[model samples]
Target: MKDNIIDARGRACPEPVLLTKKGVEASPNGVKVLVDNVTARENIKRFAKNSGYEVKVEENGEGILLTLSR
Candidate 1:
């Protein structure tokens, strides 16, 4: 089954990424994280990559969608 989704909009620098990290830790399969800032997107991408999860990031309107699968 697909894991959880984390919507981290309106949250400033690092919070989104931090929350995403927590979501990743909580998931046995993986998770999808949505963030509206470039920095947050990059941070999640870096974390996912470093953690060895397969990641896909897409542009959704003004926000970014990150799908992580382990």
Candidate 2:
């Protein structure tokens, strides 16, 4: 399966979540979302979990990487 990446870093709130939702809907395999803030990271994780996708998070110096897989 191919992985789709959504770069949401430097963006605020719902924008990241919205981009992630779009990416998830467009990609059958999975989506990787990059967010620089805690709020965006948590929001995306919550959104993905509630949408029935398996969520994983990785912390980095720049930001967090959220992996949403079905």
Best by TM-score: 2
What C-alpha lDDT does candidate 1 achieve relative to the native structure? 0.85
- Please give the RMSD of candidate 1 to the true structure: 1.5
**What are the runs in model 2 whose C-alpha is more than 4 Å off?**
none
Q: Which number leads on lDDT?
A: 2
Candidate 1 pairs with clashing backbones: none
For model 1 the local lDDT of residue 24 reads 77
Per-residue lDDT of candidate 1, residues 24-69 (tens digit): 7788578998888888888888988898888898887857889999
After superposition, the stretches of candidate 1 with alpha carbons farther than 4 Å from their true spots are none
How do the residues 1-70 of candidate 2 rate in per-residue lDDT, one tens digit apiece?
4667789999988899999988977895689998999999889988998899998899988689998888
> What are the RMSD figures for all models against the true structure?
1.5, 1.1
